[model samples]
Target: YRELLLRQRINEAAQAVMVAYAMGGDLDQLAANYNVKRLTVTPADNDAVPPVAAVMESDEALRLRVPAAFEGLSVAGPTAAYEFH
Candidate 1:
């Protein structure tokens, strides 16, 4: 049991470091490297059923956005800049 618990914790820690699997603060930190910040959702005041009170970008979405940000740095072309990375 102890060994299994240790392995689980290790797996969690490992995933936290990877953008493909990281969540919350870990994902936030990774996004920061690209100068990207997660967007927040604003609930409608008059709607009968508003969206979640605190909706933040999902890890999957943020992961996609981080790479796209690299495209913006290009003076020549996105493809060229992207290929440099």
Candidate 2:
């Protein structure tokens, strides 16, 4: 069924996210494991957004904004491949 297939893909995506997260701060490993381009993001040097919100709410991370089903391993915009403080 279409619904079942969709659920399967969602599961895969979630698993991918978990896998990438488990890689710790290693972007190379994340990209190599997921077979996708990897890049890191930080709010602009002068931007006003809180760094925590930037990672927790930005398009890069789906952990907050979208339903668990709709969020894939990656989204349309930047993804936070690493965190620096």
Query: What TM-score, over all chains together, does every model reach?
Result: 0.67, 0.25
Q: In model 2, which runs have C-alpha deviations exceeding 4 angstroms?
A: 20-85
lDDT of 1 by residue, 1-85 (tens): 9999999999999998888888889999988988888876554355447543666767787887777777767888767466534
- By summed lDDT, the worst window of 10 consecutive residues in model 1 runs over 43-52
lDDT (Cα atoms) of all candidates against the true structure: 0.79, 0.41
Q: Model 1, residue 9: what's the lDDT?
A: 99
> How far is 25's C-alpha from truth in model 1 (Å)?
1.7
Question: Number of clashes in model 1?
Answer: 0
Summed backbone clashes in each candidate are: 0, 0
